[model samples]
Target: MNIDVLELTAELVKYESISRATNVPVTRHLAKVLRALGFKVEMLPYTDAAGVAKLTIVARLGRAEKGGLSLMSHDDVVPAGSADDWTGNPFQVREHGGKLYGRGACDMKGPLAASICAACRFTAGDLRQPLYIVVTSDEEINALGAREVVDRSKLFADLRHGYGVICEPTCLQVVHAHKGSLGLTITSKGRAAHTSSLKGVNANLKMIPFLNEMRKVNESVLTSRRYRNDEFKPPHSEWSIGINDNNVATNVSPAQSVCTVNYRPMPGTDTNALVRRTRKCASDLGLKCVVHRTGSPLYTPKDAPIVRTSLALAGRRTPTTVAYGTDGLAYSEQMKQLVVLGPGDIAQAHTVDEWIEVDQLHKGVELYTRFIDHVCVQGLA
Candidate 1:
């Protein structure tokens, strides 16, 4: 069966599946298609803290086995920042000049389409082991979709292979490693009183020491390792703090001071040590620290089969690394290794009028088909 890649991409684009919005309709659409193609489709629904209904679609082909290949994608896209910022409807697909334009045309939807088409090609072919097509929600916000799937270990016991693909916007290159993200919202509390009183214990003032300590911690993170891998652009983890709100009025001492702290840990760095410092600092300062989001950095060896095969398919020997996080991290607990490789450029991912070249879309499908052949059909021979 010949699946129309662009038509699938456009159909997904038209649904307006933003990270914060409901994705059931789009999930059903994908489920219907995968089911028709003889995949055992499973719709696993989950609810986040904010009560948003999310889902992860796991469609498997062939007999279940360990170390099988999996193609993964996220169903959610980043919010279209402003409607006025776009020339055409951001929710609908627009094809012009050999480019397909829409919100997730590059960041994801394009890869999802290509993966589905590529996996569809195996419907009539025999397989020694299984192949999986996984679509999860909440990647743009925090990769909660993949996290949820990973947490459900028993649900994917047979499919928790050591090899997998994260269909992010890698522009057809294979990404073997990426940085981890840790975010927190800290609040300093104190009694609110008239500024005239010196005993008022200003909440904003209580945050000064914490801020200074965090600065030093961040500096230490930068120098964590003597030599950094040039593969990662910055090649070092970064931390920053933002004072969301502080003094509300000149005459009133604020009752609370709120700030956000985010740290991106590079590969080979001890994330637990960094995490402990932030928590200990907040405890010593009598400030409440709430974890907002946390994603572990993924590091796969360059010589890994997934990386080697993908590189061979793309005719590139070097396996690159990305700065951003992906759904791959969600499956780290289950899958032994995961690589981020797909169609489109990362530069166009979150732009107002994001797009993927038609040529890139076709190439993505071809690469995926060839990958299936190399890993599944040839049995990694």
Candidate 2:
């Protein structure tokens, strides 16, 4: 079957894989396409703790040994908000003025199409090194699918080859590093009573001092030169807390309040350390602070061959780091040498009407083609 990158991107966008419940169709669609390409395909299935149908599409086109590169993208997208907010249907691809607009158009499906097309092109030419493709679920949902891939243990060793390219939107710049993010929950307890009862402690009142302390933690991040990375936009680790549930029904004092803090930690800074510090701060404040869960930051040196060649082909400077996390960290940790390069801009992703430049998509095709040449045809053989 002939594959048109743009059309495939459009077809992919049409599938509303909002969350795990709706991901089967998208994964099957990708698998069908890959199977037709003559690759050995595997459906790695797992049931989440919540018993969601989780599947990862893994296909290999060549030998696994001696190491090869795989192209990866997530099949899921965040739920589209308010239909009235978009000029057109968020699920339907609309093209005007050299741009393709739709949900997940920029978030990922755009790059996914480009990567698949590049792989098809490479396979058509009988590339020597193995080329693999994996379309996994749950990237937008706490990195669950990727964490499953890692936990499976044997998948990494089974790959035979190690390197991978995470087709995340990067506007064609080679993204070698990116920060890690963790979602934390903090809770404060108090006694409930009437507002007139001066003796009753307001949970809202107890949260104020702790919130200020959280702000100080964030501010401390801004001043920490140790966390600086010139490649990232903000160039610093950041932390912010929000009261997810704050209610004191006016006359009555609420007994409990919960705050969710989002922490984005840079490569040099240890996410664990920051998490530990936050927990201690919560402890010192006499509030229950939970570490929740965390992910490792991704960092691939710019000097690596894959990074250098990717930058040289794109004719653009390699970014130091992207503030947003990707499936790249898992790939890097598992594959050891992973480079992130793809089309579209993060700014456009997850917006009401996400779009990708047609020209950028074409450029991505060319870059991926050249990368295949460097890694498989020219470099591998």
Candidate 3:
């Protein structure tokens, strides 16, 4: 109950748990702290494609009661640029003028600390239901942690029908929906040939139609405008090329070309249909669409009780939506309610010398404590 949310946030920022760096140490660190706080902690470990170790820390306090509450956060931070570029050590927590400056301050570590502080207070207040702290790794790269949790939902059997709060920076606002995303690096291979002879197939030329086909897909999505939600910017699904990798020489034909395609699936857009149309295009073109990253969009109903309650707590008339993604959407279907709400401005996230206002951190702790009281303690509707 007496937890120093700001101090705890500073301690967490001291860990260099960047996305490229494994989060095992910080996770272990949090696990120890949670254990000391009388919470049951479990570690879910796995190895990524790069052979990097990853972990998901699920800590619970109170009975293993269904319909409990979950406070979610991703522990991984984006890479801090060169030390010379920063005014202070990015890993070392620095507070100046009431702003906590650190790599993950605004991005997530601050919110995670708020959750921990709230959990301590809520536990002391006599919780009727369980309190779950879902700290996942590898969220910056993708929704790896969310996917793992969904796949292994049975591990946290207590919170089966729970509501979720992804502690992503939202300036104390509530977000109920965002676009889902999938990215692919597709390649077309062809034989090399001399420019004048043209004896070999040109991969660059071969890729044009495929590229155009993808453009058509984008155009189709834009024109159809299915499931358009005006709350979101543009209000339409999107498909487009990201990186145009063409292996071509001025005098010789290109033997291989690769390009990155990305899809932002709007809520209600059929992801299966999108992928099916994509694969069909690749199949017909004899190209490969190698999927590299993907995540489900957030579309928690605006009228959900949790959303309505969160809006009321935030003193807002309507639940706004973020254009970017968060960890909650990936697991929204698992629960009756999920909302992305936290302190700090998302605009500050991923910026150099990232910081969260000290006031925001305080407000976050208070907000999370209220949520715990409403959902975890009182079991209010």
- TM-score for each predicted model, relative to the true structure: 0.93, 0.90, 0.91
Instruction: For candidate 3, write residues 228-263 as lDDT tens digits.
Output: 667788787667776454555777777888878777
What would the TM-score be for candidate 2 when compared with the true structure? 0.90
Cα error, candidate 1, residue 185 (Å): 2.9
**Model 3 lDDT, full chain set:** 0.82
Residue range 1-381, candidate 1, lDDT tens digits: 789899999999988889889887898899999988888887789887789888888888877677667889988888999889998999888999999999999989999999999988886356776778889988888888787677664436777754688888888888998887888888998777788986566788878999998898778767757425567988876678788545668788788888788877666666677668888999998999888657777888888776777788888879988888887666665566788999999999999999999999999999888878877777772
* Clashing pairs for predicted structure model 3, backbone only: none
For each candidate, what is the lDDT? 0.82, 0.78, 0.82
Instruction: Choose 2 or 3, whichever is better by TM-score.
Output: 3
Cα lDDT tens digits, model 2, 1-381, are 457889999999999987646577888888889888877787777776677787777787776655667788898899889989999999999999999999999989999999888877856356667777878788887777777666663445655255678889988877888887778888988877787977667676667877887888788777877667676788876687789545647787788888888877767776667678778878887888876557777887778766776778779774546788987656556565677889999899889878999998998888888777777776542
Worst ten-residue run, lDDT, model 1?
A: 153-162
Candidate 3 has what TM-score? 0.91
